[model samples]
Target: MSVRTMNRRAVLLAGGASLLLAGCTSTSAPARVALAAAPETPKSPDSVPPHVQAMYAAVMDEPYPIRASRMHLVPERFWRQEVTDPTGEKPGSVVVDTTDRFLYHVRDDGTAMRYGVGIGAAGFEWSGRAHIAYKREWPTWTPPSDMIARHPELERYRHGMEPGPDNPMGPRALYIHQGNVDTLYRIHGNPDETTIGKAVSSGCVRLLPQDVIHLHANVVSGSPLLVV
Candidate 1:
């Protein structure tokens, strides 16, 4: 195979989203097919729209290297964009519609910033209202006991894995809580670019690393979040 194909496959499998934590341990798509249609592979940044490339641009100053996501891997609809407020909950409210796999952060204006998120498996999902208790930059990752049982090698990280590119938590993590109680779920970053809009994870919602950074800066402690 060509070098480009190899690179695309490598990126898709690198730290896949399913291996991410179902809990905050420490830190931290849809498609159509047509007959004879060209296979849909992740697109190079230059081949994608300029806005998308800009939105997911690589970080120059992050402690760990955070390359821009393969924007084309995710449906264009899931790419971070603004839309009219449909929740009407209130400004500054963060809403996650797991059914539609969309997260909306209502702005003071009528528009809300919508992001596509990869949710967890069935029977492992969390819904209802919660709040962002705090935020972490490159937060450490601690594999829960159950996870360790499944992958004994993770026992080494029982204490917590140092934050870095390889850390599944990516470069940012938002701790979700319900009234001072750690819900054990998080809205965190995933360096893997392929899991943005599919149900491929354990439970925690995963956002592209770049998109999470944008969200991490705008939100504050106690930001109300509704997962429906």
Candidate 2:
């Protein structure tokens, strides 16, 4: 087992424990592929697998509103799918390969559920073993003071950003911590589908809104998360 893989299993693990978030905010830098073409779709109607389209379909009925994404904006490879468990970690653990921008949730079976991710940019990337300290739906966002300095308009939200479709933390966020300290990183949602599989976040892992929602519901709190 990799040191970064979570072994101790617990769901909703830190019940009622207040989220100790340092704010995983994104910078204004544009993605390498500023506008993607084919996120919820494949090259052609014949190319798409029925499951991929359903995964990114408009998510209504959420406590917070989520707009249906335009298909064909992000590439198909980043879409959620099942694949071989390359990490060889215990079932139920989570593994993130930053280099490939893929997050895998190992299953009891011989495969893993993989979702595309937007990782931290060159200088802001981080690695190592961590456990999900907690998770939240419609989580509040508080941008770090430095992030505010760079984007003064964010100053108005210095205290905190409310939960909404527009919130940077999106509808769900998984807080990552090392030992007892907050690593100040998160696996959260981005409204933009084009950013998947690219290094665009400040230091957090970003996923499409629907993708993050699925990951959060399935991955337990306090699950081991390995980022390499």
Candidate 3:
């Protein structure tokens, strides 16, 4: 098995052992278990992934909130634009507009937290509504085989890449799913702040570190995430 897979197994084993020792066999309360299972530090910014050294070097200057680009004060119009939402909000929810590159966390007060995002390329784009089935603080990124096929330079790390500052997912990830199907699209952090309001991703939603940190704090599993 790959190192990452083995690490994941070790984590599961350790968590299971702890649970067994604690005599807490209840699965009805998964939130507690999930909290216990979350990884604290998934990746490091300075360490480059396999063959992505150049791309990583371009973005490995400084951490978020301190990066020069993040402090530039972006306008709201960059991420706040209307879209067709005939179904309306379902109590507390969220919606993302790929055309305008904005994500809205709908509040009960009829307003929302507007944040800019980087969207997928034309052919790799996704539309329609999906639920946030899972959320991770710092997610590991296993480049899809297609991605490696297109960019053979990335083939070396096809299995899975460790989570860290260099990981494209940034500081957090919210996995969207339609029913039981994994959309494979994620609302994740981007170390490249310049990509904000840009349509240049491989099907995943990319957010500047500041915006992602804000979204991560507010979003929860089961939240409705509409991408259109």
Instruction: State every prediction's TM-score relative to the real structure.
Output: 0.80, 0.82, 0.65
When 1 and 2 are scored with TM-score, the better candidate is: 2
Error of 3 at 42 (Å): 34
Best by TM-score: 2
Q: Output the TM-score of candidate 1.
A: 0.80
The residue-by-residue lDDT of candidate 2 on 1-228, one tens digit each, is 232342221222223233233446643433443222333445554565566667777888898778765446667778788997777677888888776678999999889999988877656677767789899999888888877876687888888878887788888999998789887788999888767877767788998888899999999988987776
Per-residue lDDT for 122-190 in model 3, tens only?
455666666899788766776665666566666556676676666777767887777787767778877
- Best-to-worst order by TM-score is 2, 1, 3
Give the runs in model 2 whose Cα sits over 4 Å from its true position. 1-23, 26-47
Worst 10 residues of 3 by lDDT: 18-27
Name the better of 1 and 3 by lDDT. Answer: 1
Error of 1 at 183 (Å): 0.9
Superposed model 3: Cα runs more than 4 Å off: 1-69, 73-76, 79-87
Tell me how many clashing residue pairs each candidate has: 0, 6, 5
For model 3, name the residue pairs that clash.
Answer: 42-163, 43-163, 43-164, 44-164, 44-165
Off by over 4 Å in 1: 1-47
